[model samples]
Target: MAIDFVRSLRGHPVRPPASGIARRTSFWQRMHVDPWLLGMLLVLMCSGLAVLYSASGENVHVVTAQAIRFGVAWAVMLVLAQFSPATLMRWALPAYLAGLVMLVAVEILGDVGMGAQRWLVIPGVVRFQPSEMMKIAMPMMVAAWLSRHELPPNWRALAGCALLIALPVGLIARQPDLGTSLLVAAAAVFVILLAGLSWRFIGVMVALAGAALPLLWMNMHNYQRQRVLTFLDPESDPLGAGWNIIQSTTAIGSGGVWGKGWLEGTQSQLEFLPERHTDFIVAVLGEEFGLVGMLAFLLLYLLIVARGLWLAGAAQDTFGRLLGGGIMLTFFIYVFVNIGMVSGILPVVGVPLPLVSYGGTSSVTLMAGFGILMAVNAHRRLLPR
Candidate 1:
């Protein structure tokens, strides 16, 4: 099969008709499938199912539903991986525009769920988060726009890109979903950083952000501010606003070195921990599998990040490099923020642990981003110098 693929790439005609067609199709299907990336994802998915079962109190139905979501996401990943980087670039602006429009639709016609207006429901047909689409579109749009010019973009270009990022981020934040908004903004920033923006400008922006912290604090909703305060002192209101963080930290700390073992964790099974199957699933992992399991999960995550960076570096074009790199960095942020929040090191925001949390939208959206990364890698060799 490998020989046949090489021959096809070299413009050699195959003599065996049936075998040639079958092999050619198989090769093409497998072409964009990065072994390391796929392997890591598989491991994470299996581990997620195991932990989710335990987190949900050994509920087979919960794990079964999550498995279905993973199946759909995996199919979407493979299908998306078939597109060439050029094809993805062509759709970048339109995709971003579409996401923005959906976000607007969400603001006006979106359904409220669990105290947030983030999902758009199309009557009886479909319901989904528009912000999830921005996870990919935002970075792609920024990369596409930046690729049109020289690296170390001018102030004007930076400003324009910031506006592009700000629009959806502003809208999503108004949904009061600080987590998704931060993720979207970070993804765009990764593109800008990869595009070689000026360090002086970055420093100035950071300083301005620091200066505006007070104003930002003042503008935050009461619940949002309470989260920050709870992060600083979870003991201040241990049975009230701090219950989630306190319970999470206890679950993590009680696990000691080797964990309580599988479904034996008292905190999660007893319903002491909050969001055991979603945002705080890592705490369940920690309590059940201990520090060793957490370390192993981090290793797999790091390998995925490393492979993504390698692919981004190997890409032959600016768009591929920026888009691929941005996706990888944003993925890293997802892991870091989720782990930090679970361990009580950061304010609790509703960022789910990628691939390891029992959620449909986030899992699907993340897998699709990897699909784009695979597309970038698979098409790199086809590009001319």
Candidate 2:
């Protein structure tokens, strides 16, 4: 067979000869799996395991719980990516409605934490953050809605989508969960940008946002206002309002070129770093793993975000592209804000580091977004081809 193929090729104008084997490759199989994402996730899990051991000293339960959550989240990511974007679109409305109802339920009868109602706790299981669901659902809902509508949509449709995003964002903000609220807002902005809103319109909205800042400021709680002021100058109140920021900055600086070694971080071990296993987990990774580990972790995130962007750009349909872009960009915000706040470059807004922070709700939600991205990539060549 080989000799015959070579002979056949010799008489042709240099055409490539086909192999005898029949390969079966699905779109799913062809997609770039983003190993960097997978690697980063594993690194995060391992780092979490190490940090939680110290952060939750004398209580091994945190690490065990986080391990289970990580397994569940990975499973969810795999399952989500297996579906196509069209299927996701079909499911988006129903999911959004269910999420909205849950949000309403959280408002009416949810657990209040730190004076904010944001979680739905069921018996014998973990409490779910409805706002997290809204982060995924709102984008899908809008993308699906806009996919079915005309381009440069009329004011009415735009208003409807804006309302869809605004309603949940407002609820989350009122939950006093400003971190998640800002995330939801950022996701919606990406969706709006993908929908092709004009630059003039975007500029006008930015101006309006600037004008509304004072009114929003007035509505903020004392602690919330203090956070902004402290962000402006964390050293001003190092012992009181600024303790967390001070500790976080100190931990990161102490790590130097390389980390203090996993589980050996003085800040994390001595318990000086607040929220060491949650909001400031990145600081733990920094102190223990050092700059090299941090760079590797960031490279993984860069790959994840880049692959997601590639999928969005390559998507055959507008909805898939926008949805893909929105999901990945939201992931970016989660990482950016968490690390920024931890390093004192930004205010502590309480956003968890995606997949790294010890929280089931955030871990699961993040994986689901990845799954959606996978679905988009799996169906890239299926449209009118």
What candidate 1 gets wrong by more than 4 Å, as runs, is: 1-30
C-alpha lDDT values of all predictions: 0.90, 0.81
User: Cα deviation of 291 in candidate 2 (Å)?
Assistant: 2.6
Q: Provide the clash count, candidate 1.
A: 0
Clash counts for all predictions: 0, 1
TM-score, candidate number 2: 0.88
lDDT winner among the candidates? 1
Q: What is the TM-score of each candidate against the true structure?
A: 0.92, 0.88
When superposed on Cα atoms, how far off is each prediction in RMSD? 4.2, 6.3
